[model samples]
Target: MPESNTTLAIRVQGLEQKVPTLDGELQILQGVDLDVKSGESIAVTGPSGAGKSTLLSLLAGLDMASSGEIWLAGEPLHQMDEEQRANLRGRKVGFIFQSFMLVESLTALENVMLPMELAGAEDARTQAENMLQRVGLSHRLDHFPNQLSGGEQQRVAIARAFVTRPDILFADEPTGNLDQANSARVEDLLFQLNQEHHTTLVLVTHDLKLAERCVTRVQMVSGRLEAL
Candidate 1:
């Protein structure tokens, strides 16, 4: 185990990800090292196939790396079992994605409440309602994903991600599918909530404007981290 920094929200050392291909082992990430402090915002910008989303997944414990050290809030993620990692994610991580992965069957409010319900929270409905209101979605609470437009669905997704108020938030191309106006709106809300809650934010994006909004920016190319 590496020396865990008490003030760091996330730390990765010598991280690597490889997949066995017919030709040979294909490396997606190579010797990536990073340290993100608590309450800090980091933007990862790179071209397609640069492993930006893979890095975010590894940090959030949604995917495992072939070889690396990953510490989240001082816990050794690489050392944990799948179940243990899942439990940790439930308690400490939140995620938003490019596609706005909301359940089409569930209403906006229900979608927001799902995680809390799964965690056996006592006030799931109340918290869901409040969070929807916070995201300016109180009127759309009963709307299903398919019923909402792209921006509205993304708003629901944002509410769902933040409803838990996890210590860390990971967003991958959050505004990729939105128009300029909606993208700006979502960006403002994201930063506002992050400030209000002091949550560590790790974003994978192609948008330079979005990257510049973050406190720290890093570029990735050919599976390697580079200073921007």
Candidate 2:
């Protein structure tokens, strides 16, 4: 089906981002407009300085845009305060970063269980364990982030992001640190879970193969998006 016929999962209009710098204000995004349908997957591809990550951060509610309208799952981010935005994200958003922001002190199982526990799930440990097993990390449940390889750590992050089954998932260079085999594994896992849960996926990546797997693709050039 066409995207316009589907319900919108995300909507953006006249989005702009500007930051104060030594010289003056730096413009990161300029009048960006976008619409993502429910269950749709989109890959944002661009050069390092083109503001892809900045755009992801805004869309995920990690940071506020300088000016623009952003609606995620029908919630208006621009109109909400920081706390309100955080609450909305907790309920409907999942984010995976390029750096694999896992808690160093927590083991694999514990890391994945944290979100579910915070959300008051009754069986957080059981659910986390099952998610880790699905990612082929059943043997590494007790391993800390430092004890795991980079690929293993990335898988742990992916498990943690998917365990809660969020309405939307935003990933920033999710496979940047993985080997070919593990990258393929992660990609399969991403789409598998996406299909099972009907989750909207938005990822920023430079890998051509990964980008091509998405249903829609866009390029960011000097803070403006162009369809590809």
Candidate 3:
């Protein structure tokens, strides 16, 4: 194990991920290292095909590393199996994707409840309701994903991601699909929620303004970390 960075909410060291190609192995991450602190917001910036999303996936333990380690909230992500990782994620990690991965079949309320229900959390309903209201979607509680606009859906996704009071939130291009007005709305909502919960934010973005709002900015180029 690497010497754990005590201030980090998420930590990675010598991390690498590769895939077999017809020609040879394609490296997506190359000995990358990073550390994010509790209550800190950091934006990951890079051009397309720069492995920005791949890096986020590795950090979140949504995918495995060829060789390396990720310490999230003081637990070792690499040491956990898929089921163990999933369990740990439910307890500690939250993810907001560009496409807003809400359950199309379930209403917004039920979608948010899924996590709380999985944890068998007491007072799940009350907690879920509060989360929906916090995201400014109280009136759309019974609405399905298709029934909401892109912005609304993203808001629902944000509500769901945050409902767990996670120690870390990983967002991949969260405002990518929205218009300027809606993007600003969602961006402001993120800061507001972070303030309310003091949740550490690890956001991957192409938006410069979004990146600047964070306490730190991490850039990637050719699958390597670069100073911003």
Candidate number achieving the greatest TM-score relative to the actual structure: 1
Instruction: Give the alpha carbon lDDT tens digit for every residue of 22-105 in model 1.
Output: 999999999999999999999999999999988998999988999989999889999999999999999999999999999989
- Model 3 stretches astray by more than 4 angstroms: 1-4
Q: What are the C-alpha RMSDs, in order, of all predicted structures?
A: 1.1, 2.4, 1.4
Per-residue error for 161 in candidate 1, Å, reads 0.7
Per-residue error (Å), model 3, residue 130: 1.0
Output the better candidate (2/3) by lDDT: 2
| Residue-level lDDT for 159 in candidate 1 | 87
Q: Residues 1-228, candidate 2, lDDT per residue (tens digit)?
A: 234534888999999999999999999999999999899999999999999999999998889999989989887888988999999999999988878999999999999999999999999999999999998999999999999988889889989999999999999999998889988888888888888889999999999899999999999999999999
Q: Note the residue pairs that clash in candidate 2.
A: none
Candidate 3 lDDT, 150-228, residue by residue in tens: 9999999898899989988999999999999889999998988887899999999999999999999989999999869
Give candidate 1 regions above 4 Å deviation.
1-4
lDDT for model 1, please.
0.93
Order the candidate numbers by TM-score, best to worst.
1, 3, 2
**Candidate 2 clash total?**
0
